[model samples]
Target chain A: MSEEKKRKKILEVKDLDITFETTAGNVHAIRGVNIDLYQGETVAIVGESGSGKSVTMRAAMGILAKNAVVNKGEIIYRYCDNIGGIDYNPEYDENAVWKEADILKMDKKWIRKHINGRRIAMVFQDPMTSLDPTMTIGKQIMEGMIWHYKIDKQDAYNRAVGLLKEVGIEDAEKRMKQYPHQLSGGMRQRVVIAIALSCNPDLLICDEPTTALDVNIQAKILELIKKVQKERDIAVIYITHDLGVVAKVADYVNVMYAGKIVEVGNINEIFYDPRHPYTWGLLSAMPDLGTDDERLYTIPGSPPNLLHEKEGDAFAPRNAYALEIDDKLDPPMFEITDTHSAATWLLDPRAPKVEMPKELKLRIERMKKEAQANGSEL
Target chain B: MAANYNAEPLLEVKGLKQYFTVSKTFMVKAVDDVSFKVYPGETYGLVGESGSGKSTIGRSIIRLYDPTAGTITFNGMDISGKMSRQTQKDLRVMMQMVFQDPMASLNPRKKIKDIIGEALDIHNVCKSAAERDEKVEAILTKVGLAKEHADRYPHQFSGGQRQRVGIARALILNPKLIIADECISALDVSIQAQVVNLMKDIQEELGTAYLFIAHDLSMVKYISDRIGVLHLGHLLETGTTDEIFNNPVHPYTKSLLSAIPIPNPELEKNRIALNYDYKTSGIDYTKGTEHLIDGTHYVKCTDEEYAKWTK
Candidate 1:
């Protein structure tokens, strides 16, 4: 039995619509998307390329490209009463009042002063590209704290060294003096995580943080992020397409497709009992070990091109279980459980039931049996 | 299921050592004293982390970079020494390569047809332009692309489609062995599955042996018949897919396998990666002999190291 923990809404994006002006045409990147991030829980956004996963997070961070236009939507960020949201739990204070702010309406100057680095921090996919080549590792980590809190040079230096040690880097003093190029890929990513945690942000946005690293390093980085989240009780938004990474990091799963949240569910619900056909395709397609099947299942067609004018369901062309109604209208998000929901025509009460791929079903059952044997949660 | 033992090996590397001289006194031993046999129509996966020299082994086999030492034999011919013009020409037809990044590998300036058919022009295999177009279109359709797509440039297609073009480029030569260096690593999971399925379909149709060099363990295990685990430029372990996954011996090999991210949240949460530090393990590759365990499973270790690891 799990304890009833009070979950507070931290970041809310309602009906987000973003378009980019290109030479070919106006690409409607984010089309009427909605995402809800709660306090102290990791939420993962999974999708194929050009599926608007990064664009949604970029919108939340106020880092959208100049050529992009936000046609509609609102992003609400709630500032908790306690610093770092440490005392927002009911045990500390039953009345945890949150002061809400509309992130979209805020000007760049105001946002930079309050929200950008102090309350929220982001780690990019590639650490090499994100870090300044000319700047030393220590300066990059210290700059955020110095700029946000206006701390003294000595204080910032001391904090940077501490953060480096916290991220599991050895010889922090020597590493702080070296540049990004001097460090390995895994070490550089550790430095990036150190910088992100330097400002003590409550919400950490990691967009494929370990995608550019090797597999062994990836496991360590994922562990490090989880360690920090537990220690500080920070809410993490993990943006990645790797299902394994999602299973390792996320508490909630948001499956995005064609700029929309096609499926939102708890990690178990999404992995074990997925309803959407697109979700089924993604789950079945990953090449797993010890499988006898010669052919891996693939989504029948590519994602819909956003440059062209769309019709009913953008996924209708690729869905194997697409109903005639899908051609005429977009499917609404049908609720499966309190924490599980999927956008698909097959979820309609009148529609014929469709089963997930046999291989995926068997795989889930096998995984559940394994977990049960291991005495872990199933 | 694996390389046919009765059949002759398609490619063999004996004591392969590929070292890069950084300075007059310093050298980077990218691939150090590694040897493996890839039989006909089998997929031999070379897996390692960055600087583990999986790609170096592939490059040396393809003659992209001349190996600093060792012998590389292809189809019963020793291709390690200076290649005669006839031998080079023959090798071109028997071997081809697929690079990691489709964007960087393909000629962005040229049309898909030209990019895929460049081998035709180089080898003078096609009689006329119409014939070249026909060959290119056939390969395109084989990889799940249309004839009209041959007219577009690399930028015109999506990441998956561009990768198809890369596969089409390799297929146009009708090569016996294709060294796919992280071919599906850059694509999304769905698209990666599609590309991998395409590769499998092609392999079934042509019976081509693939030297698949990648870091993704799951995918490597899925597609490869036999796997060679590389670490710090040495082949620490080599075995069939089942042997490598079910019963890994070396501590480094075991560590690599443990680091694979499980897709089930329940199981993944219970997982902890086993750590193996070479400096602390007291295992030196420079002083070891490869010992065969059984059924195509081999581990490069000394007598004491083997005894310790097996126990």
Candidate 2:
């Protein structure tokens, strides 16, 4: 089904490595990571805190901290340089091509003027912190357009009200004049989404956008994002640790563990037929509504310390089915299908085959049965 | 299991009301005429949204914020208002609380030993310094921490470890009831499970009752024997875990249950969210009353709606 849709690669990251120089020691925040984001699709990065999910997205957006260092990587973003009547359709003719810039190599001024908030936008976790309390909501929403596109004040103002209405905010004109504190938590988030969407960016990076909202409000926000994505054909990268949220929104899933993507697959593959042990632990650890078990199946140990250099697989100590190779060497990404891969020694053909835990298997079966009863596809 | 009818509840809250004066003209009814009972060796989960006043009810029960009206009966003694010094001191040892934020709850300047030991010292539970140290060490170990951790500051520990310290301080009092207010909301999934398992184990070992206050429905269903659904500072529904989850009668309860995001992708896709509108529903809570549906299920509704709902 995914192959049938024509997808344009909007962003690509190859071998991205990030480190932080802390007083205690240097923290290896991001390992040799890679990701491919296409147009009009949602990809979720799931992990616990300190798993470097936020750091990776921050590096992509050129918003890393001062103490952070990009050891080696290339973040290539593709955008059509419409000036001077340049041909943009490269697929039809070899001469027609778009401009590509490596974000890491580009100067800060160039990126800020051309790329950041123009072709890509970010929505932070806390709307209160992201939205300026001093400025009116309308002015904050219009600031991006006026600065980036050099639009007139009246045009920006008209579009800002439209954007607020599009985000499902009632009384858009009245709310535009209100400050951030005057709005409720859900309304503040809606305003944040409106500001992020004002620029009409190609990709919207939402970093735990709904973590601060209540469940009903969270559902509304997720639905709003999905609706906006469909209407505008914008690719979304959601960084969150909640599996339930991931299952609802994502088409693809990346399970990160200790600064590395341990597994990458479609949502169905990750939830129903998970290959990595850490993914299994995450799924089992969540207490579902129907779960009646005495105790949740935890991942045994806490996340590994990133201050020290990691040896072999970072999750080897916590993996219950770890093989001898997991302790000696880091495992390569073993392909399960064209769209699914897992970094685990157990995926090696020479290693003995092991099944997922019985509890998880039973749960998957129950989920499948429930889905069938509801006439939904898994 | 059925509730013990003859035995007195460990904690009984009757017509509890906590109001805050937001302005000179307006008073915010944080907890408005709510009532529940926490039996000995049972977990009573209180689930609601952020402004629904679940935390306010907890604070009122623990007397952190004195209630504006109604009585709180602990071990058959009415300890609501204007208690004697000895009664207040005795009530302190019988009831304790675990706050939500571990970092903010624990004093950064004090060592874990002193933080937990202060409770013992205030209550004069220990005879000497050695006995206090021994008790602190024992409680720390009981919460899955090493005795050596007692010497470290709160900043040195992780989020889960700091929550363990909070639990240790609450357990050191050897209270009959502990009100855990969103204690596991800040931790990760794996660590949350560990902490929850620890709570269950402690409850089993000590047979202590708990007023588990949180917004997460699945966790509440897992830990609670009976649950009370609160909305706008009112107790809308109260029932056993099974009765509340499987046979929700109140429209508010149904809406809350439907809003919970289950983990299964396919199931969640098929899930239809029920939005409850109080304005359009035309339900006046002031005139509404609690209606018993079954043996252990109760729903708040008007007389006409109660007949329809029960029917």
- Per-residue CA lDDT of model 2 for A1-378, tens digit only, reads 277878888899899999999999999989988889988889999999999999998888887899999999999998765442211233455554577888888878888877778778998889999999999999999999899777789999999999999999989999989999999998999999998888778889999999888787788888889889988888999999999998888989999999989999988999999999999999989888876787777889889899987678999888889887787799989999998999998889898989999999999999889888888765
- Residue-level lDDT tens digits of model 1 in B94-197: 99999989999998899999999999999899899999999999999999999999899999998999999998999898988999999989887888888888
DockQ of 2: 0.69
Model 2, stretches more than 4 Å misplaced?
Answer: A1-4, A82-97, B1-6
Clashing pairs in 1: none
Cα lDDT tens digits, model 1, A1-378, are: 125977878899999999999988899999888888887899999998899999999888888889899998999998754542312343366575668888878888888877877788899999999999999999999998888777789999998999999999999999989999999999999999998888778799999999999989999999999999999888999999999999998999999999989999999999889999999988888777646676778888888889995688899999888899988898999999998999998989989977887888998898889888989766
- lDDT per residue for candidate 2 within B1-311, as digits (tens), equals 33354578888898888999999999999888888888988999999889999998888777778889999999877888988887788788988899899999999999999999998888778999999999999999999999999999999999999999999999998998899999999898789889999999999888878899998888898888999999889999999999999999988888888887888888775455788867888887767787888887988878899987767
Top candidate when judged by lDDT against the true structure? 1
User: How accurately is candidate 1 docked according to DockQ?
Assistant: 0.78
RMSD of candidates 1 onward, in order: 2.3, 2.4
Interface RMSD of 1: 1.1
